[model samples]
Target: MKSIVFTFSFVVLFTQLAMAQQSNEEQNLIKLSLDKWQWMADKDVEKLSQLFDEKSKFVHMSGTWKKGEELDIIKTGRIWYKKVTVKDTAVELFGNTAIVWNRITLDAVVREQVAVNEFTVTEVYQKNGQDWKLLALTFSSVRDTHQIKH
Candidate 1:
């Protein structure tokens, strides 16, 4: 009876430790996704490129789906973000892949037009070695519909 109890206790302790380690991994992945948003706000295309995979795909809010990587978008003058505010951010992890969804309001100059657009953005990330890299992204524009009672 004593040996059986000892074995059960060890199994429970090991399982809890494994769970804690997995939680930390998920949190770190979410942080990496958030950092990409910061880089976009700063217009740091170089840093942003590092976060993206070589074959990453980016679907812009304009309904254009770009292939290749962030460099292609940066070269075309198609994306110029000024101020970006992330809201209601949520992250979910599945094995080595993670997805981050958030509401983003941006003061951007796209195609020479200064616009304030609210969008729901989803960023897909994959863990590579010790770092997380963005594998794809899709964003859709949302109309801010708020009623003010007079």
Candidate 2:
């Protein structure tokens, strides 16, 4: 009876430790996603390029693009991200893949026209050996007529 009880306790402790580790990983991924947003706003192409996979895909309201094309657009001021305010974020991990959903408010300039928009953005990251590389990013515009009280 004592052995059985000890085994159960050990299993419970192990499960808790595993859960804590997984939570930490998820939190780290969330921080990485936020950093990517900031990098975009700042037009930090070097950092962005490092984060994005060579074959990464990007889907925006305007159109879909490959990594190089998107980077070029940012580099040339075609789509300048002025600010990004993340309202909410959720991250899920599946094996080596991490998926993140961010509800964000963006202030940007597209073709020299100022644009303020809300978007539900989905980002997917794949683990490459020990590193996480962004595999895909998709943005859907949110049309909200209500203003925030705060």
Candidate 3:
């Protein structure tokens, strides 16, 4: 009766706490994603070069390119990532690999023309030694109503 109800409540509380708590690795990965976004907006190619794997791929609507080309684009401001408003973010970890999905509204300058777009950006990362390197980043245009289902 009362004893059983008390035990059930304790169990439920414990389970909810466990579910709400995230591991350190998961927190670090999410932070990395957020930092990457800021670095992109800042055009910080020096830090970006270190974060991006040598064979990393960047896929955009117009074309796909490797790390060097992507760095060059950022450095030269051929397409400036002026601002990114991240509406939602979700990150999942599988062993040493992590994937981050960000639903964002991006304000950018392309060939001196301003473009505002809503997109879902998928970023894949792999642990390399003590650091996590970005392996791939792909963008998919989506509507404003899109949500990240974690």
Candidate 4:
């Protein structure tokens, strides 16, 4: 009876430790996603390129493009991200993939026209070896009727 009880306790402890580790990993991914947003706002094309997967796709309200094309647009000042303020974020993990939803207020210049808007951004990241690369990013404009309290 004592051996059985000890075995059960060991299993419970092991499961708890595993869950803690997974939670830490999820938190790290959340931070990475936020940092990516900062990199975009700063126009750090090199870092952005490194984080983006080769086959990544990006969708904006105006259009959609692949990784290289999106990088080129940022590099050439065609679409400049001036600022990004994240209002709320949620992250979900499915095996080795993570999906993040961010409600943000973005200030940017598109085709030399400055615009500021609120959007709900969806970012998908996949774990590759020891690193996580962004696989997709899609932005949808938030309706003006819904106000986000600062």
Off by over 4 Å in 3: 1-22
- How many residue-pair clashes does candidate 3 contain? 0
Candidate 3 least-lDDT 10 residues: 17-26
Worst 10 residues of 1 by lDDT: 141-150
Q: In order, what is each prediction's RMSD in angstroms?
A: 5.8, 4.0, 2.6, 3.8
- lDDT at position 15, candidate 4: 100
Weakest 10 consecutive residues of candidate 4 by summed lDDT? 141-150
**Model 2 clash tally?**
0
Highest lDDT scorer: 3
Local accuracy of candidate 1 as per-residue lDDT tens digits, 95-120: 88888777778788777989888887
Q: TM-score for model 3? A: 0.86
Which of candidates 1 and 3 is the stronger one according to lDDT?
Answer: 3
Alpha-carbon TM-score of each model against the true structure? 0.73, 0.86, 0.86, 0.83
Overall local distance difference test of candidate 4: 0.88
Kindly report which residue stretches of model 4 are placed more than 4 angstroms away from their true locations once superposed.
Answer: 1-19, 144-150
Steric clashes per prediction:
0, 0, 0, 0
lDDT of 2: 0.88
- Cα lDDT for residue 73, candidate 1: 58
Query: What is the full ranking by TM-score, best candidate first?
Result: 2, 3, 4, 1
